[model samples]
Target: MRKVLLILVLCTAMLSAQEKPGESRFLLRGYAHSGVEVRGDETTFVGGSFNPIFLWRQSDKLLFEAELEVEYENGETLIGLEYANMSYIINDYATLRLGKFLLPFGTFAAKLHPAWINRLSSKPLGFGHDGVGPARDLGVELRGGIPLGEAKMTYSVYMINGPALNDGTNPNVEPEEAGMLLYDLGEDNNNNKAIGGRVSFLPLSNSSMEIGFSGLYGKVGNVESKYEDVAALLYAVDFSYVSKVSFLSGVVDIKAQLNGVQVDDASYFNVEDSSNYSFSNKSSAYYVQMSYRPVNMSTDFLNSLEFVGRYSELSFPEGALWTSDQTQYAFGLNYWVDWRTVVKLSYQFADTGAHESEGEEGEASNDAIFLHWAFGF
Candidate 1:
């Protein structure tokens, strides 16, 4: 804990001493989300997520950002850090960032920005805060944008050297671990490291498309005899289109993994066949969503009273993977309260596959409707 505080202090001191002309601003912002969640079996959980953020910009190229979040469930409170980072711009084409920041991975991971709250679902199916990966990591990142005539290209590259696992599952009692890959290797030094990028192109004034791919490979150092480290691969693609009648958008995501028990001289699984098993798991899902804003600049309601709908499906084969199929549909009406706030009402349904022992057809999923208030600055 002391080390974490020390690092934050050092980053803050560095940014305070460097400031460009007319490039200083301090801002505070936040929002809260409360709603009832119903599962496929009709179980309901009433909960809410409240996040508060603070940002300081010393210059157009140097800035500090942070967020603190608390999730409330009944009378219990779960508190944690969401973001704390200091960024330095090298030039118009590059920026160097240090401290804890969001890992630039899947589209949903980075796009889950706080201010853009109401524009999305109460929960994004399998992304951040959903058990896959931690929201932020301690590391350094490089990100920037390039110009191409009337259109532009954007990119991000990052390397994190903190907790290898996001679930507080690390076995190390020390602050940070570093060493070699073989002689000094062993299981003592397990850390998280990754690299990824994104590219977008605009062929028209109101329409644009993007494709992204990211890979994460690391090990959770200490594990029980029956569990080995994990190697994972993830792929994603996304697109969005805008027009007078409606807007169309979609995303496809896939994940595959390989993992097992570690081996030693006295280890169980050997070259010969054995009862122990190694597993290969794969899961993928996709969604097509569209919304129609009947009111436009030339119409009444001024873009209010819009209607939106979405459909998504996910499936995993029945082998080593926890096989299941899920389908979700949502409909909503949104009214713009002001330039930076909006009110929304929505309904959603989800269905999951059944086990062979159940022996009956799966039942229709439960439905939920919610009213949401959102704002950002």
Candidate 2:
């Protein structure tokens, strides 16, 4: 508690410090939220996050930025440095960034993840912190945007310390199991670095539509015998559209994303013999969401409300080592108090695909309701 308070004090002091006349030296901003959730037969109180962001303009061409998050969950507190990086603007179409930063693999993870920005309360399936998609890494990156006639194109490329493979005896670990195929942070078990990037295109003028594609490839696993070389690859494509229509009398927003991953030489062919292994790796996931907000409405309350719907799924091939596949459906309503504050209510239904036990087919399912208040400043 003291440490968290001290960090906040330091941030406040930095933001409040006096600066030279006509010189913009620093700025601060962030988003936070808290909520209560009722799931199945249990109800829990949640302390969302106290995320603070700092930015410094050292010179005309140099800038520094960092974000820190303090969160509480399940009677425990956790702190993390979401991103800390420096950027040097080379020109109109190129900027260099070095240090730990968010991965440029997907639009949602890189751009629309802040509590104040995301329309939905929860992340899509297989795209959360430790899900199938890569989140952040430590290294250097190049990114920028370019204007082409009436359209725009943006790109980001990075090379970072890749994920490490789990060579443990147990194959059912939370994240690193054969079925989960999770990646370790801050360390690379092997010497190879992962390389990936995203490219986005805005094809229409005065339109909020973007199309993007991303890919990442690298090798994971220790150099020791029996666990030598496993190659990992990920690919994703996403699109988003926002527009106002006459019939709906509102602004409509739609987003969709699909991603897949493959890990070569993932499992051993012979459980009794470690030397016998095969390369049969496959996994995929996708999500889609739509929302509408009335514009130019007469009443204040009606103008603030928005309706949302979403569906997502994650799957693995049949006969795979792990026996789990998941699908989710969600509906939500958001009321914007201001540009930087919101109240949200949502319900989610989830199903884990059939599992056979004792020659009988059975499925697992869950239902949950959530209420949250979020703000940004």
Candidate 3:
């Protein structure tokens, strides 16, 4: 990985030098965020952070993106190439993007590549892998738009295949086998494919609405788990209303999964003998959010604030299902630092159900206050 990254940087530098003076149409963009917080239990003194991002876009034909992060929990270093793709412009109607990129999933997941697309809080809860997998993947996709009488429509379709296991932890072990086995007897079946799509419509010149749906079905059978299958489905609807004086946006996100004869995680998988757990078990999570901004985009500086809030719920039969339901409330304030950046602060409250096991620490009502600085170009 290190050698590959070095080569990428060198290639980007060469591309930059070859361009004529001020004639190069190449683009570069990046973002960084860090937060320090004292949770409801202030004694924890938790601090979380992520390193800066780097990207090189050569006239939209070729692009390279990467990120390096140091986790605060255990202080582990993680680095990966998020995107290194080549794009072909097929006239003005559409563009063909081939290589490692984002899948056409949920609204938030699709827009995660651009830091300024939405508030940072809208992330995390929706995607897996701590919002990383929720972003991009090793895949190929097509994206573009079409014009209508008074409005326009946009769309995306993709076919993706890559490692589903997370970087920091082993995704093979069942949650029930916490510290029992260090390795799996079965072969790693990360070789799988997925398909997804999304579309948006604008009935008026300045206002728009979108509905998206995505599904994945794959077989990851190796020697040990000969018939293990992993699959998932997602759906979402987004509405945005923008006028001269105010802005309102709302979203409904839903997701479900079925893992047959496969070990997903302790909470979602069961591998015990004669358990007969091979049947397709269904699970889901969803959230509804609305945000209203009183200030118009024409404002010079950070001239206004928006009141935003959301409610989310999740359930899993394999996990502590009775105790898995939760509700969260968040309030945010946005300040424009410049044309490409904004500073945001928000607070969240979460309530969980009671744990079924006696050893578990049941449910707890907790609060988290966060401050995030987001920017893009």
Which residue runs of candidate 2 sit more than 4 Å off their true CA positions?
Answer: 1-24, 169-176, 269-279, 317-320, 354-362
- Residue-level lDDT tens digits of model 1 in 1-377: 99999999998977876653456898888776654444445645456677788889987878999888788776889887777899998998898988877766545545644634435444434332322333456677888777767666667777664223212123352211111011112123343453434454555543344444444444433344222354334445555554553342222122221111111211122123333323234445556656665543554475555566767665443322234556677777777676667677778877776534446454567577766666665
Tens-place lDDT digits, model 2, residues 210-236: 999999888766666355577778888
- In model 3, state the lDDT of residue 314: 51
| lDDT (Cα, tens digit) per residue for candidate 3, span 96-204 | 8887665555555545334454554434342444221235665677888888877888788776653243111245544343212111112334555656566777767
Candidate 1's clash total is 0
Tell me which of candidates 1 and 3 scores higher on lDDT.
1
- Which is superior by lDDT, 2 or 3? 2
TM-score of 3: 0.68
What do the candidate models score in CA lDDT, each in turn?
0.53, 0.80, 0.49
How should the candidates be ordered by TM-score, best one leading? Answer: 2, 1, 3
RMSD of each: 11.4, 8.1, 9.9
Per-prediction TM-score to the true structure, in the order listed: 0.69, 0.87, 0.68
